[model samples]
Target: MPEQVRISLDAMGGDHAPDMVVAGAEIALKRLPHLKFLMYGDQARIKPLLDNCPELAAVTEIRHATQEVTMDDKPSVALRQRRDSSMRLAINAVKEGDAQGVVSAGNTGALMAMAKFVLKTLPGIDRPAIATYMPTQRGETIMLDLGANIECNEDNLVQFALLGEVFARVLYGIEKPSVGLLNVGIEELKGNESVKKAASILREIDLPIQFAGFVEGDDLAKGTVDVIVTDGFTGNVALKTAEGTARLLVHFLRETFRSSFWAKIGYLLARRSLQRFRERMDPRRYNGAMLLGLNGIAVKSHGGTDALGFSNAIGVCHDLIANRLNETIKAEIASFEAEMSKAEAKNPDNVPEDTAQ
Candidate 1:
């Protein structure tokens, strides 16, 4: 028999709480047969929605919690004080082994804070970083520390690169994924002290990953590298900027095409291709962000995600569970630790120093 994946979803989280959350859960259950969802929130509101779709009742189990953690509450306070918050309960399900993973579209800070407290980090990993998959010219590149840890060190960047490589290989099916340190310049001598030191450490690491030197902001959408590693601050800025640019460009395209009859006719003539382009560039298709270097799987979705976006996140969670991504990451990290230890023993004084403050 195949392994069953039970996911705990915080139904009351997100801007479209309960409604979109419920709808996404329904879509996931209908599309994926092996998925079992534990919806955590008030039962009264969720039941009516479930009643509208009787068939989903069989696959989804509701764990009622009266209170909810709003996006405004501090994550630390919410985690400690709100014992019955839906987000906390959902994470508890994963921590207690009642569910394989937890998915939420709540406050990003609170979710990260709660996740760190509940799931903890894998061995040899100091912190877990938020990683997202971006479509690049080369294919899909894994961008790490998107917003998880704003202040990171050279050690963090190196570890992020390793984790990103493993994720790309497992999730994207890229063998020996080329790794690049996000920097202001492509030259080896560019960037701050941290990036410079991280590049050196990466060069010394003997792993299956192919270190592709430094990459710039323009290189992200151009698909110059498979995995882009940077501090959370830089990565978050780059990701948001890219997202804004993509949206602006698409908006402009739509306006241009709809402005005149000739353009509308042209759009109609190329409707299929236009739809394909939209699908490819749509951020909703890549809504899930993985909390990498964790002991267990925890996926975070955009706080404002709609039903369709949440559905995409569910599909991503399903894919990660089905592929046993956490296990694969565990093995890869272990191997990396062994390699680092051996290298350290051989050249204890020669190990590159971390430049991140």
Candidate 2:
């Protein structure tokens, strides 16, 4: 028997609604047998699908939700109106201690807003950050502030570093992960004021974090460091650009293969190798974007993703809760804060007071 990890699902949220949610749960059950799903949605739609998958049905308990957050609903509107919605109800389950984490494929902004409002940020954390793992040459690199905060100050970047560092350990099982600040260039005077100032502060800080200086655009795929920290604006743009580039490369490869008979013959000869490469680059393998620094875990699945992608998202939520990631991050932040307090007391300029937004 494996350890049980309880997760709440927004069954009626997503482009495909209850069908994809149920199907994803079925797929996740095969991989994580110890998962207990607290399915939140209209029982009428979800139960019918659960009946067909007895393996998942045995471990799931459906909770009725009359409403659901729509894809187009703004975060503010969703929070103001959709109280009994499936997404909100699922998050509430985590808040009420009924589930360890919540997984949703609904509106991204709405989910983040609700999770932040409901779960709140962990101790010593001013704001929560969004983080996710992307495959790199070394293995996988953890990147943070991926569409959570549009514009962040130096202090916020430092906070993202802390969250990303903790998540990298959970992701790669490394004790002390090398953290880097994303920048235009690696030179000391090349980047903007924020990156330069952040690097300066991180170098001065006396914490457990392994500050790995700055990483440029080309360093993303090189796996320059285990953890990449940036503002949500930059991180989000980088993530989208990477995804687009991957698709572009795959398209070019396919076009080249079909351009000539000899090319097609060559493709056939390398089909097995190409397939391995394809599987390695698949985005579904890295589907979950965790909203970090929240008191409880919340994983956002791509709304357009299928059963396989959604299952991967659920796995992220499970691993996060089982590893007690939030507790570890809270502890790390507390430890750093204590150290900073002592330094600040000794020298007023040790840790600059964060007054800027």
Candidate 3:
């Protein structure tokens, strides 16, 4: 780990704007005192918040951004018109070596566009994928392509699997993490041609990954594998659906507790256990999503996250920088490419080809 991990924050990017961003920084700074911040946004709106947190202000440098990218702005429009927006400036800090990493809670598409254009993808990586870790029955599981590449072929799926594999190792300190493709069923013949071919290639590869074959949607919560890889379209839908389900469950618990006087007494008796469950299921703890395969580190904080959630997001950025994740991914990609070459040379027929494409 570096003596200091400098993070650039899009102070005006989230739903709560400077307030959430500033408070999150304050919380993160307590946990990571060596952190220095580059706060980019309208100085007028951000200064007052900083004033309230003198400790944060002491190590922070605010850069005024004239424009702000709105939540409704299209990716292309935000990239072109909001060149001086807080989101762009924060990302620019990373590209210019002014910061070790950048965090944003703004428009996801816009952030991806700006990041891809500015930082570019790592060598041998065809595209970047969105990855994050979530709690499971057994433990935390790493998943990728959560809305980065909407339509991925066998090549992209394979790359996501490799990326997810690396993420599990780096983030969880896992050795030879089990990797699975998200599918309609665990059976070999249960998916589209791309997914089937992707599974085939993964099985044939000699990489460090433990390819677990196809895993159904139900397998996600079961921790059937350490890492799950899927195209963005499917991954995004799954992610949103899971989030909604969590909220729904919470609502149901609330309603159930208030249904009767006896239920209220039961809630008081089970308060401690319920608190533990709440902490385990807290979405705030899993607020950060990494744009994997990028040359530089960039984490996307949930747009509606509060101080605690955003702070968790910042923690993620710190971990990535401290772990030298990109360097590890580069080395892994090189090895993967070498393995592919060897397999193709040894038995070309074994390597799966995308016949549909």
Maximum-TM-score candidate: 3
Tens-digit lDDT string for candidate 3 (1-357):
548889999999889988999999999999999999999999998899999999999999999999999999999999899999999999999999999999999999999999999999999888999998888999988888999898998989998988888888887889889999999988887899889999888887788889999998878888999999999999999888887898999999899999999999999999999999999999999999999999999999999999999999999999889888899999999999999899889877655453222
lDDT, candidate 2, 131-250, per-residue tens: 988999988898988988998877788889999999988756889999999998787776767777778777777899999999987778999899999998999999999999999999
Clashing pairs in 2: none
Model 1 spans > 4 angstroms off? 354-357
**RMSD in order of candidates:** 1.9, 1.9, 1.6
TM-score of each: 0.95, 0.96, 0.97
Could you say which candidate leads in lDDT? 3
Q: If both were scored by lDDT, which would come out higher, candidate 1 or candidate 3?
A: 3
Quote the lDDT for 42 in model 1: 93
Cα error, candidate 2, residue 310 (Å): 1.0
* Model 1: pairs clashing at backbone N, Cα or C within 3 Å: none
Least accurate 10 contiguous residues by lDDT in model 2: 348-357
Candidates 2 and 3 compared: the better one by lDDT is 3
Clashes of each: 0, 0, 0
Q: After superposition, how far is residue 132 of candidate 2 from its true place, in Å?
A: 0.9
Worst 10 residues of 1 by lDDT: 348-357
Sort every candidate by TM-score, greatest first. Answer: 3, 2, 1
